[model samples]
Target chain A: MIHLLKQQWWKYTAVIILLYVLIGGMLVPLGPSALSLYPVSIPSDTSVNFTITGYHTHFEDAKDLQVWFKPTTGTQFYKADSIVPIINSTVRIVFHMPKSNLANKHSENYDLVVNDSIDGTLTTVYAMTVAAGTGESSPAVTPANQPEVNQLKFKAFAFPFQKILFQTIRNTFFHVPMWFAMMFLLIFSLVYSILYLRTGKIEYDILASQAVATALLFGVLGLATGMMWATYTWGQPWPNDPKLNGAAIGVIIYLAYIVLRGSLSDEIQKAKISAVYNVFAIVIFTLFIFVIPRLKTVDSLHPGNGGNPAFGKYDMDNHLRMFFYPAVIGWALLGFWIMSVRVRIKLLQHKKSLL
Target chain B: MRKLLCFIIVIFTVLYTSAQSAEPIPSLMESNLKIYVVVGVLTIIFSGIIIFLLSMDRRLKKLEEGH
Candidate 1:
């Protein structure tokens, strides 16, 4: 097991995988999306002209342009009467609402969909609200005209253009992997601590300390990256968030572990006490990070906590998954490599002190 | 250390060519507007890794001198 730590192959593999993640995560462009629409609400049985702003859409170059409003509740699509391209990223769409459009439902919000050959399909949810009309007729439901944009000739491999996230979505490859790597390293150290308690070997103690130290580095990096991303997207470097506070607490707990080690003079006593403390610290750390933030009463802005969908289910598609999984493995391997080096150094120092 | 540098350079060269080939007309203006945020993020992570490695190197050097 110790020999595996000194192996050169996994270190090279870690470097290679990380390079791939950095290149692929950064360089890929974002997919086309409808950014916004002017004058969101419209009464039924009236013509409304909407000016839609798009991101990364080629409206000027598109020969086949189709625009429509899809209701959240119904399958009936309200197709645009006239579509005019104002610029490459802007379009003017006119939609005629049928008489008594709100007979079935008193209120409905329409999702705006713009489809073209070049950029494929772009949609903005809840772009327009249709209220009850004065007309005394039944709601006319138009049949769906599924556009032939499905057979797209060119589709770029790109990240999903999330509304607030934008380019900061690339931080997923870096920031998320840090926490994951930290988790793996801390778990590894926990196991080593257990082994040390069972067998009373100083090597196990050395491994545990080195792994915790490496995990602490990763934890600090995670906090820094998260702060930067939060500053840009959430408009605050540190929000009053449960998950953030939990992470801070977890870091402090590990820091106390380090302090405890530094103060102790006797090697065996230090090892014994610290190993026992490691078991206790990890349990509390796990509870703070994984359990507390996810509690029903605790509201957290971080995803996968407090009723929010995790990146895996909603934001991350196959394109992101391809790189994200490998990134986790790469960062974890790199953390292990660093920890192994520290373990070797500690062992060498121990031997020298004995001599 | 020299081998590692060589490996990184080779990978980056390949990445550059592939990126250019993938998108013929790279949208510089749009990328410049927001891509710098990603650049900043990468910088922070890379610097953190570099500093950690450098500190380890210093520790090793001190140990070697003692020996």
Candidate 2:
């Protein structure tokens, strides 16, 4: 395994796979999504016209269209009376309000679900609120005449379209891989540090330092890309997010490890001190980046944090996984390649200094 | 190295001019399409990689000169 690490073929593999990831991630279209619904509230027992906007939906091409208003609590669904296709991505739907209270509550939120032969089922949650009126306080009536939805038409290969994350979703291939690369590089540094401590070898020390330096570069790239992604999605470049802050602290701690090595003059002393510091640094860095952000008490705007469902659960469909896994491996291999080159340079410098 | 620098500078100039042409400055970044934002991010990452590679090249040059 160690011998293969010094080989040249993996670097070419990294380049080829990264090129694939870049092309595939960018070129793939997004699946249809119901973006939003207008007039979010309505009183019971009245027919209301609602405008539902969709993203990448083929309303014009859809042969059979069905719409439904399902309450948040019950299995009962109120079928739309009529639907008019406004445009390729917009539709005007009319739903008759239920005569009785749906959940026996004062008001109940309904999810706007639009389905068609070409676009499958698209839903916008909490889209419309139906307030109770002077009517019989009975169980919500399930419309018996609900039309059976046609066979869903899924595009051959596409990323799942999500609200607020449209084309910028392509950044996942470029931005997310940076952090994975950084993590792997740091792990390499940590392992080399342990090897140096055990063997008392200056070459292992050089490997450790070069890995950290490469990791720092990837860490900075990760931060820059993450900030760019956060700006458009979260409406701010820097929000008070736990994961963001943790990442920043982890980088700073690693920076201090570099500073600690620079302050020491003796080669053996520098290696010994920095290797010990590297161990502590990696531990604290892991705690900051991985542990603190995931604590139940802390809330983070990042996915999979603060009780929100992660991209793995829904957003990372089969199409995304096809590209995402390769991206992680390619970026990480590139990082290792860079670190190996640096180690070679350091070894040459050491030999020249001895001569 | 000089050729690489010139190439990067030209790319930046093209991006800047295209971004500033005919539309309000913020709308290009703020548009619902958001494809430009992706382009911006890709540019930043590619630039970072280029810079890192260039620095490595510089270090190798220095070592060769010493030899």
Candidate 3:
């Protein structure tokens, strides 16, 4: 039993990591979201009533919740006269503002800050705008937040699915990692092909074949998840886009290679021909993904395309990099485990055929 | 049956076009926590698949060992 534990440690670890990614990724609550601010247009000198709505507000137990209206250009917030909660998600507030200098600024933008003991604080930019507010009469009142609530904290393990992505961002944990794992499998498969070419070994050929099969499995999985994500984000399942087409072509090339291998009966002849094809396929697939996609005249809808903002930019703010990195490793390990099992089965079959 | 199929197609086309034009459907995220239910169901299906594959792998090994 102990020996078994030592031997299959990686398999267990892969399962555990995947479980962590799956359960923790889904269950963790999103940070407090500020949805809208009302009466965005207001007169500067006069006090005005404003309401802000939020999602997952946790107002029932928010022991000492604080709300502030901060201007984007100013050092101080237009201190609220009173912040009254209508419900868990909705709040109505009144604010007294300093007189305005229409010459100084046409419009004043205020950020909405909400701090709660349990849920922490969230600041939404451009929460409200004052048409005529910037005066000397109003004194700046600094907010006093509770020590516990003053600091921002996040759950130990959670995925931050951003606003643009909404729920669809969860697909990143599955889709992107599957592709990365597929690449990992294919890289080894490419290496095994090279080794097979050099040594003329049947074992290397078997390893290459199994790795390609497993990698292609992940490629298909990635494509499906990607399509699901696109249906949500891009509003279509199959966009006539280059990257998607390139990826599909890469899959087809390998699918043809698979068919080519199965058709041949001569072992040595088969190994030599398929090894050459596998090497060519990997190179062509890499070029399709890396080189041609970049050079294409068509603007790719994929993130990080045509000088648009990419994954990393959003990743930092949302802490997507944290969960996404582990997801990649976990999926890669699972893919390798699947490939290894297939390779072992192939070896078994080979042995039986020899006997 | 033809009428029913045509009705279904019209409904699908309408739904698809509406989704295409309107960028956000935040109510899906805001109300009833339906997204979590969806993600949960997907996770369960995926787990079932992995489990089935693992069992198949074990059986294959058992066959290999037996003969």
Candidate 4:
């Protein structure tokens, strides 16, 4: 029993880690969230009543919740006169907007930074903008900007629930890891193909073919998951974006590789031709995914591509990072486990056929 | 129990985030809006294929036993 356990440790680990992600990814409550500020566009030099609504924010127990309006151009955030709570998640703050000289030249955008003990410090950019207005003659108002509040607290493990990706963000665990698994499996197949060309081992050929078959399965799943994610979040199952098209093309190229292998009757001829084809397909696949998407002038729906801010900028917050890394590893290991089973079955079949 | 929690989260998200029905982001799949229904159908199809494959494997194992 111990000997069996020793050899199959990774199989157990994969199951356990996946169980953790399945539970932790969903049950983990999102940290205190601040969604938006009402009437985003506020006229300058007026004590305007701003309504701030948050999601899962603790306004009641907050010891200190300070609000500041930081102009995009300048470091200084002109402060509000007073902050009042209408509800736990909603706050009405009267911002004594000041007449600024910068407003004349350019419509300077202001970010709303809310610092609280409960939700930590969160900022929403372009929350309000001091519209570039005519140089006005007005009495000077007290623009007492509150100092930046330091909110450092030990946060619990959770997934980030953004506005666009609110519920669908959970798909991150399932969808993204499929691609990661596919890439690993495909790369393994590519390596095996290369090894077969070097040593001309029938074993290498079997492994290579099995790996490709598994990779194809993973790739199809990856595409499906991505399409599902796109359907809900991006309001489409498939978008005509360059990256999406390139990925589809890459999958088709691999499918062709599978078909080409199956068509040949002679084993040596099939192995030699297919192995060479695999090398060429991988090179094209690499260029299709890595090179083509980047050179696209048209914008992409996916982040980190086509002018959109990368996940590093903001989308993948620390909380999501906690589960995300584990999710990737779990899926990769699971893919390997399935692939190993298939390989064993194939080897058995190959052995039987030789009899 | 885990599935229950996940289901609840999905429901909660659908209910709450639906309030944020503002600008619909650009989508090419808008032409084939029925594609929203495709995922469920695909799932059923895949599940059937898997069951069939499992049965085939069992049959293959029997064939190997005779050898």
Best-fitting candidate, scored by TM-score: 2
- A317: Cα error in model 4, Å: 4.3
Q: Candidate 2, which segments miss by more than 4 Å at Cα?
A: A1-6, A36-53, A71-75, A84-110, A126-155, A309-311, B1-21, B24-26
The most accurate candidate by lDDT is: 1
What TM-score would chain B receive for each of the candidates shown?
Answer: 0.51, 0.68, 0.47, 0.45
Interface RMSD, candidates in the order listed:
2.8, 1.1, 4.4, 5.9
Residue range B10-60, candidate 2, lDDT tens digits:
998897788688686567776866887888888888889779988988998
Regions of candidate 4 where Cα sits further than 4 Å from its true position: A1-7, A39-48, A71-75, A96-110, A128-138, A144-146, A151-154, A161-163, A294-317, B1-67
How close to the true structure is residue B42 of candidate 3, measured as C-alpha lDDT?
A: 59
Error of 4 at A73 (Å): 5.1
Q: Worst ten-residue run, lDDT, model 4 chain B?
A: B28-37
Q: Encode model 4's per-residue lDDT on A163-255: one tens digit a residue.
A: 556555666677777778778878888898999999998778877777777777767777877776676667777888777888888889899
Task: Please state every model's RMSD to the true fold in angstroms.
Answer: 7.7, 4.0, 7.7, 7.5
Question: Which digits, one per residue and each the tens of the lDDT, describe model 3 over residues A1-355?
Answer: 1233236778888888888877766666555667678887787667788888887775545657777776676555445678788888888888765543333566677787777765567777877777754445454345433323367644333455256565555666777887899899899889989999999989899888888988877877777767656655566779987789889998898898889989999988888999999989998999877666666475788766544466578544455665677888888888878777777777777787788
Q: Give the 10-residue window scoring lowest on summed lDDT in candidate 4 chain A.
A: A1-10
Candidate 1 residues A134-220, lDDT tens each? 676555756585644445523778888887788888888999999999999999999999999999999999999989989999998
Q: In candidate 2 chain A, what residue range of length 10 has the lowest lDDT sum?
A: A136-145
DockQ of 2: 0.66
The residue ranges of model 3 lying beyond 4 angstroms of the native Cα positions read A1-7, A37-49, A58-81, A86-88, A95-158, A292-298, A316-322, B1-67
| Model 4 alpha-carbon miss at residue A50, Å | 3.8
Q: How would you order the candidates by TM-score, starting with the best?
A: 2, 1, 4, 3
What would the per-residue lDDT of candidate 2 be over residues A236-292, giving only the tens digit for each residue? 888999989999999999899889989999999999999999999999999888888
